[model samples]
Target: MEKANSSVPKPRKTSVLSNYEISVSIAFKRDCEVFLVEFAKQKTLSYAKFANIWQLKNMSYIFADQTYVSLLKTLCEECFAILTQCIIHQKNVYMKIGALYLLYGLYYKQPIEGMVKIRVSYDEYTIIKDLMDEMAKEKYMEPLFIFAKLKADVAFNYVGCSMPRSIRFIKNTKKAFTAHTLNANFGENPLSKFEGILQDESVVKLQDTCKRYEMALKKNSSIYPNIDQFKSTIMDDLNAAHKKLFSEDHSTPSEQIETDLKILNSRQEIKLRALKSENATYRGAKQVLTAIDLE
Candidate 1:
């Protein structure tokens, strides 16, 4: 058989995420979920607003809670995966930081996700303390403020040696975080400080979360590279987390049966009473009209 035009656009690599991309997409989705819940409750944010929040410099206002915090943990793993995948793919660092930026808003709602929630060695504690002190002294020195180059350096240092050796490939992850953090203006979506006070407590919680995640990323000092395998492992963990969270097992209340019946009967009776009242008004109006005609 003839080699029927071998160059016929050999199926453009439409599927780009790979196992790594899938994981990253999931991470982005988690961040989206967090945003949707907080935004819905607050009725203040939209997708465009979220994009702007990721681009803003002064991010004191965005925040979330425990529900969002759990959601952020999933996103964080996804961020790590994206960072590693980009390195392997020789992709841009900007893409990776963009992912982190999105997480920033979600984490802002629940700072605990990025916090060093677990106990660490004295050395690790010292590192974190110093970083926080750095942030305290110069808010601009915050991880979100720095260039992607330095940000990746910080990420490597922060999670490299500290996390398990099984995930050691994370160290290879590089520059994407810094690129996106620095380059994209994604445009500023302004938020008010007085508005902050007027805002729901949930907003405060989410913003605090962003600060915590930034802190943790800064505190980490290990220079570990990203490993592709970690994506699958973490994906499994995330699935488990989701399953654990959404599994509803509570029984319905018995009082609901009687209450529902009463409500239905009362509604029907009310409608009948309303119809009778309307009939009386019409009859009274007709009698008035009849009397006027006779006169």
Candidate 2:
């Protein structure tokens, strides 16, 4: 038999995220869910404008939250995996770059107003190297290699490690090559930012949701209030959250039910109904989304 051609690159098999990675993706997706719920509740702005509010700078609470250390620890644990999924598995460009920029920012994230910035300690710097070479094997990912190189250099610098200067990419890149991404403004994509905002898969979805809501607001200027109220009922739409409460297996408790339903008007009634629905559900946002997301 004739040998298969060696020149052609074989198709890359899709990488499956591990259970840990899946859990991370889902936990990472949690805030997005909450934003989506709130965004859908908003009858105030267009999608583009609405998305601006969700930016990390605007979300001042995250930096100040008592869980900041825990959150940073979690991101340090899974950021490599998150980057891998974004580069190899994620198809949405904005989501992909959002991951890139966010990871890049975390490397040098600065403290502000006594709230700590993102960091992986010297002991944890090795995490950045875990999947970098694997992702860099392909030529198209050269930019990613350079991105990783820059990040790794920061780690080396942080630890006061000295490195020799080296020759660079010459054979592969063309003289005409230039990064012209919208964010680049005709320059190479920095892939990192000094004071970047928080962005990720969920943010992108929330932005899409905003676009959808924006259209609805324009289409139903008067009825959008009702639409927003109806949309708020999505919390109970998750089956796992209400499994025992609504199932034949169990009976819902009355106090578990918020018996204190007070309504001053029709709007209050709608909101009260939403509050009651939320009360009946018993799962955290991460757990709810994790149960539904494909593994």
- Give the number of the best model, judged by TM-score: 2
**Per-residue lDDT over 1-295 for candidate 2, one digit per residue giving the tens place of the 0 to 100 score:** 9999999999976322233334555554444233333333333323232334344224333324434554444444344333333333333344333444444444444333332222333433443343344345533354365466555565323332211123322221112211221122212222222112224555456656766876677679676456552343332343333453344433222221122211123456787787789546544543445555766
Compute each candidate's TM-score over C-alphas.
0.23, 0.25
Question: For residues 1-295, could you state the per-residue lDDT of candidate 1 as single tens digits?
Answer: 7879966877655332234435545544344333332223323323343353333322333233324444445434554444333222322323333333444433334355234222233454354355445545755333335333334433333443333454433443333433233221221122222223324576456556656765555555344334222112333454455455435522222233335445666777898998878445664465454566877
Off by over 4 Å in 1: 1-75, 80-97, 103-109, 113-144, 148-163, 166-295
Residue 96 C-alpha lDDT in model 2: 38
Per-candidate Cα lDDT values, in order, are 0.40, 0.39
RMSD of each: 27.8, 23.7
Q: Would you list the clashing residue pairs of candidate 2?
A: none
